[model samples]
Target: MTPTPVDIPTLLEISPQGGIEGRSRRYEKFLGDMDGVYRDEHAWQDAVGERGTDDLVYWVDDHRYQEGPGALIVGTSTLLPGRYGEEFAVTRGHLHAVADRAELYYCLSGRGVMLLETLDGQTSAIELTPGQAVDVPGHWIHRSVNVGDEPFVTLFCYAADAGQDYGVIAEAGGMKNLVIADGDGWALAPNPDHTGYRAD
Candidate 1:
């Protein structure tokens, strides 16, 4: 049987937070009893308010396409600028269920940091700015923090089969480090709640 040629779109229009016209599903993270997921309990309380669920900390607009044996999942994460005590607004990162699936993150707008960590506790934080992109290695848990005044946005892409395992990060108490806003820049602080984290 002869296969028919398919035309791929050359251009995709992006919205402010990185949503592509008709190909986006928005997901949000709010402040609640995230104590089990964050290093700073005081900050979490302050940011989420005493009652919790007071704020929308961040959101992701996912645009995905499944093509035959593989799939392309693209997402734009927007972390709102605020403090969870000393920590900045961040995504509740996840690990790929496929274990060996790699991903790529491209800074679309705003400024922030990408926190990557392995299950064994090896961790690193990379600066995210306009025009910057980072490759996320396999078996790593990843999250993003917004340290700027405006919403920090990034476009990320990974394999469709690279299912997310957010429970791993929650069980580990978030990333090994937290991104906090300095006077005019940002600073990295150890996640006090992460017991397995070691200084590098």
Candidate 2:
């Protein structure tokens, strides 16, 4: 006989400033943890030397009601604004371990871009401001780039079982495209260091 699901429906209070009122867990990424995440190594080193290792770069507040495959995981991502050479502040991107799992990122505040690419060489960059959102399809690796001067905050949701594969970008020498600062906006430039994404 099948067992009844134990999780009860609950409310999640998400703040436009970045966090869940009753988050189950919170994780932070520091400047030191972004060793090779940026394309400009020397610039990254300079920033690290100036800010030190403990400088907080980004953080996530997530609420997971259950671990089942059918469960949903909701979270808020807050990426502090910064510049490393020409590239803007970004999150260490990932493709869902399940590969076919999709996600939604809704901009709550500030300005940003959702950089997405497929293993087959397709790429897209969608800029978002307050009240904007992006529906990320499966098979695409995605990352967030903050283009504004304030904290870029977003409310994200995806399958609870869609574990992240953070190594995909590193393995590919970074995503095929880089979101760089334009005169007063942002632009997508080809990542010269990227070789290509390997098939899973």
Candidate number achieving the greatest lDDT relative to the actual structure: 2
lDDT of 1 by residue, 18-92 (tens): 566655477767776345566666666665655468566777777655443376877777788777666777777
* Model 1 collision count: 2
Task: Please give the lDDT score at residue 166 for candidate 2.
Answer: 97
CA lDDT scores, all candidates in order: 0.74, 0.94
User: In candidate 2, which residue ranges exceed 4 Å CA deviation?
Assistant: 1-6
Best by TM-score: 2
Report the lDDT of model 1 for residue 114: 88
RMSD of each: 3.8, 1.9
Output the lDDT of residue 124, model 2.
92
| lDDT per residue (tens digit) for residues 1-200 in model 2 | 65544376668889999999889899999999999999999999999999999999999999988897788999999999999999999999999999999999999999999999999989999999999999999999999999999999999999999999999999999999998888998888899999999987
The Cα error of candidate 2 at residue 186, in Å, is 1.1
- TM-score for each of the candidates: 0.83, 0.96
Q: Which pairs of residues collide in candidate 2?
A: none
lDDT score, candidate 1, position 93: 81
